[model samples]
Target: MSPKKRFEFAFPDIGEGLAEGKVLELKVQPGQRVKQGQTLAIVETDKVVADIPSPRDGTLVSFGVKEGEIIEVGRTLAVLELEEPDSGGGEAGMEEERSLVGNLETATSAELPPSREGREAAPAGPPVTAGTTAPGLGQPVAASPVARKLAARQGIDLAAVHGTGPGGRVLRKDIAETAENGRPPAAGRVQPLSTLRRALASNMERSNAIPSAVIHELVPVEELVALRRALNEGRGGEGQVPRLSYLPFFLKFAGLALREYPLLNAAYHPQRQEVEQFGEVNLGVAVDTEEGLAVPVIRRADGLSLPQLQAEVDRLAAAARGRTLRLEELRGGTFTLTNYGAFAGLYARPLILPPQVAILGLGRIHEQPVARGGAWAAVPHLPLSLVFDHRVLDGVYAARFLRRFMDLAARPQELLLL
Candidate 1:
C-alpha cells in the first residue's frame, strides 16, 4: 500500500510567440475528482481562449492564479493528488502537458518542477478565484474577464448587470453601461488594459515604425454584382440562397493577381535587410472578434475554388469569433485582406501587419450614379485600398497588382473558370 502524493501541475507552453493567458475560468474545485483530458481551466491568450486540460487523472487540489490575473507559461495552474503504485519515485503525476485544442510540446515530466511539499503532503490553499492557490468557480459564470475586472473596479454587482454579449456573457461594454447609471465608484479612474488591448498596442507601435503608403480606387462593379447574384442563385438553382459575400470573390482575384505579380506576395525582413518572395498566396483575413482583431490565414488561396474559399472563410471567421482558433492558423501569411465594408465602412487606409508587405482593404459595395458610354446610370461600385510597405514595394508595382485584381474581379464569371 502506498500513500497518494500531491503534484503541482504547471501551465505548458501552448505555442510559439504565446507567452501568457488570463485564467477565464476554473472547471474543477478542491477535493473534486478529475480525469485525464478534462478541462482544468479556460485560459484566454492574446490570440484565443483555450481549454487547458489535465495531463493525468487525479483528485483536484487548488489553483495558483485568480480568474482575471495574467499567468505566464510554466506557472503552476493547479495541484493534484495521485498514487504512484508502480514508479515509487518522487515523480508520479507529472507528465506531458495536455490541451483540448492541441498537445503542448512538454512531452516529459522533466518540464515541470516537483511539488513544493516534495510530492508527499497535501497543498495548502482555499477553494476560490486569484489569491495564492485559489479555488475556482466549480461552475463558471457567463462573464468575460474584462467585464469581471471592470465590475470589481467600479464596485458594481454583476448579477444585476445585463449582458449583451454572446450567450449572455457580460462584456466590458455591458459594465460601462451599468456605470453610466449606477451609484458606484468615482468617474475617470484609470483601468487596466485587457490582454487583447495590450497586444494591439504593441502591434500598433510596430505598425507606426513602418513607412507605409496607400492607394485607393472606386471601380463600378455592375458585372461583378450580376455574377455574384448568379453564383448565389446557382447554389440552390431557385429561390433565396445564402448571400455569398463579395470577399471570397475579391480574395480569389487577389490570389490570381498575386500569381501574375509574385512580389506582391512577399515579406520584408528589416533586421536581415532582405525581401522574401512567396510563390504561394496565403491570404490573412482580418476578423473582428469579441476580444479584438484576429487574422487567420487561408493557405494555398490560388488553388481553392470560390466555393472552397467561402467554406474556409466561414470556418476561420467562426473560429476567430468563438476564440477557438489555433496559433498556427494566425501565422504564416504572405499578404492580408480586410473587409471593412462589412461594418459599413466606405474605405480605409488600413495598416499593414508586420513582415507582410501588403494589405488590401475592401469597402462595402453600394450603388452610385456613374456615366457608362456617356449615359448616367446607378451602378454598384466596390471600394478598394491597397496599402504597401514602401521599403518592399514602390507605388507602381502595388498599383499594377491592384489594377490586375480589379480587372479579374469585374469579370466574376471568368474568375470561376480559373
Candidate 2:
C-alpha cells in the first residue's frame, strides 16, 4: 500500500476579524478532488455568507468539520493528498526551501538586515559618536502625513500625546477624539470590526462614494393590496397560491420597467469605462438583520412569475435570517429594492449598491385621500423612492421608470400580463 500524504488546509483570514462561522453547506466530499480557489464549503458568519475556497489543489483526504458545525479561526478545514508527493517535497521540506530562499535573498541585498535574534541591530552604514545627532534623532518624528496635519490643525503637541500606532506614533482617531474631548491623550482602545459591521461599512462607503440620487413618486396600491389579500386567501387565479407580499408586485413592476428602460437594469464600471446592460434582470431585496442590513439577490427575476417571485422572496429571507444563504444567492444583482414600509418609515434615501445603477425604496403604505373619478376617496397609497446612479441614468429616464412602476402598482392586473 502507498503511504498516505497529509496536506493540512487551515482557515484563512477572509479580510475581516471573523473569529467563527457556521458551516451552511459542504460542497466537497472526503475523497473529492478540489482545485485551488474552488469553493469547498459555504460558511455563514454573522454578517454575510462567504464561500470557503480551497487554498491548494489536491484530492480531499478528510474533512475536519461537518455541515451546521461552528468553527473557530486557525482550525483545520480539510486535509488533501497531493497527486505528486515529490513535486515540491512535503510540507516540512517546503518550509525549509522557503527559509533558504529568504536567506539567499537577504544575503544578496545591499541594506544591512536585522539579526537572527529578532532584535534590531546597530546601523552598519556609518558610525555615530557621542555628541553627534543619531541617525533617527534630529529627524522629523515618524507619523502619518494625515496625523501630522491633524495635529497642526488641532494645535496638539505631538510630544505630549503618546502615540498608539507602530513605534509609538499617533493615529488619526487618537488625535481627533483627544482634540474633540479637550482631554489629555490616553492609550487607544483597539476594537476589531466585526465581520458584518465591516461588510456593512464597506458597502455604505462605496454607495456614498458613487454618484447617486433619489426621485420620489406616490403609487396608489389599492388594487395591489386587494390582489395580495385574494392571493393570501387562495381566491386569486394562479397555478399555486403564493405566500404573498408587496415585494413580488413591486419586483414584477420593476422587471417590466427594466424591459422598457434597460439602463436601469445595468451596472456602471468606472475602471472599464463601460455600462453593462444585463439581458436578464436579477433583483436584490434588502433584509434587515440584528447585526445590520444585508441584500440577497433573486437571480433572473424577469423569468419568474408573481407566485415564483413570492416563493423565492420567502425562501431567501428565511435563508438570510437562518444564515444559510449561499454566496451565489447574494451576488449577480442588476438592481435592488428595499421595503422600509414594513417598519413604518415614510421615505428614505437608500444607498445604491454599485456597480448596479439603481435601487427602489418602498415607504409606509397608508390610507390617504385621493381624487378618483372626479371625487375624493380614501385609497391605499405607497411612497416610492427610486435612487439611481446619475452617471448611468438621467432624471428623465428615472422619472419614466417610476411612472411605469406606479401604473403597474396602481393597477396590478398589468403586471400579470407582463
Candidate 3:
C-alpha cells in the first residue's frame, strides 16, 4: 500500500483574542476534494459565527473536531491529502507580506529615518496627511474641490448655495442653488461616515437611550494573573501554551455569580411585561473589529470548565478577525462583557445591550501601594464596572453581585469549584 501523505490545518488567529468556538456545521466531508480558502465549516464564537475556510487545496481526510464540538486555537481543525501541497503557495506568501505592511510603514517613516541635515524630511508622497489644510484655505469654498473649481470658472460663490449632498456637504446641487440665487458663497465639501461608522453610530445611540445604572468596584487580580502564568507554563506548546487573559477567569466567576444572583442574568421583556430569567448562561464577549463591534456568545458558559473556556475563546477570536463569521453565531446572548482594559483604558461605561439586564466592563490593571504584613508594597488590581437595568435590579443586588465577583476574582481558585 502506498503511504498516505498527511497535512495538518490549525485554526488561524482571526483577531480579537477568540480562543475557541463551537462547530455549528460542516460544509465538506471526509475524502472530498476541496480548494484553498473553500468554506469547510461554520464555527460560532462569542462575538460572531464565522465560516472556517480550507487552509490549503487538497483532498479532505478527516476532521480534527466534530460538529457541535468545541475547538481551541492552533489545534488541528482538519487533515488533508495533497498531490502537490506546495502548488499555489504564493498566495500564502502574499498574505504574510500584507501582515507586515503596518510595521514597514512605521519603520520607514520620515521621523524614524531623517533626511540629510535633518530639515524635517519632505513627505514621502502627496499631501495625504490628516488635518492638512493647504487646499481651499483663505478661499470661500463653495463645493467639493472639483465642483468649486468648476463654479469658480463660472464666477460662482458657494456660501449662498444650498447643499444637496448628505449632511448638506456641498455637491452639484449647491452649484445649482448658487445659479438660482444669482450668487454663490464659499462652501467646502465634507466627507460622509462610512457604512461601518454608521452602524456604530446607530448602536451607540440605541445603547445611550437604554436606562442604565452603573455600579463600580475594584478587584484584586493578583491571583488571576498567577493562575494564567501557571496554565501557560503547564501547557508547553507553541499554541498549546494558551495566551493568558483575564477573560476566562471573569467568565467563570460571572457564571457562578449568575447562579446566585439570577437577576443579573435576567432580561427585561417589554412585550410580555415580565422579567425573563434564562436557564442557560450565554455570555457575549465583545470583539472590536474593522467592520464594527461584534459580540459572540458562549452558550451554556456555566457548564464549561476553565480549559474549555480558554479554548473556545481562542477559536472565536481567530474567526472574528478573519471576517468569515456567520449571522447565527451572533444570536442568543444573555449577558455581555466589554474588556476595555485590553486597550489601556482605566474604565468605560459600556452601554447595555437590550433585553439583557446587565453588562460588565473590565478596565486596565493598575498597580497601587498596599500594606502587606505592616510593610507597604505594590499590588496589581483590576477595576470592574457593572451597568444594570435600574428598574429590574436595585443598588443592593447590584452591589452584592459586584462584591461576589470581586471576591471570587481575588481568589481565583474558588472559581474552579463551580
Cα lDDT computed for each candidate against the true fold = 0.75, 0.71, 0.68
After superposing candidate 1 on the true structure, give the runs of residues whose Cα lies further than 4 Å from its correct spot.
Answer: 1-8, 29-34, 57-62, 79-188, 234-241
lDDT order of candidates, best first? 1, 2, 3
Q: In candidate 1, what are the lDDT values of residues 239-335, reduced to their tens digit? A: 5444577888888899899999888799889999999998788999999976689999999998897778888999999988766676778878999
Each prediction's RMSD over C-alphas, in Å, is: 8.3, 15.8, 19.0
Question: How many clashing residue pairs, candidate 2?
Answer: 0
TM-score per prediction, in order, is: 0.73, 0.61, 0.55
Per-residue lDDT over 96-152 for candidate 2, one digit per residue giving the tens place of the 0 to 100 score: 533443232223432221112112322222222452222242333433334655776
The digit string of per-residue lDDT tens for model 3 on 378-418 reads 78899988999887899899989889888898998886565
**Which has the higher lDDT value, candidate number 1 or candidate number 2?**
1
- Candidate 2: C-alpha lDDT: 0.71
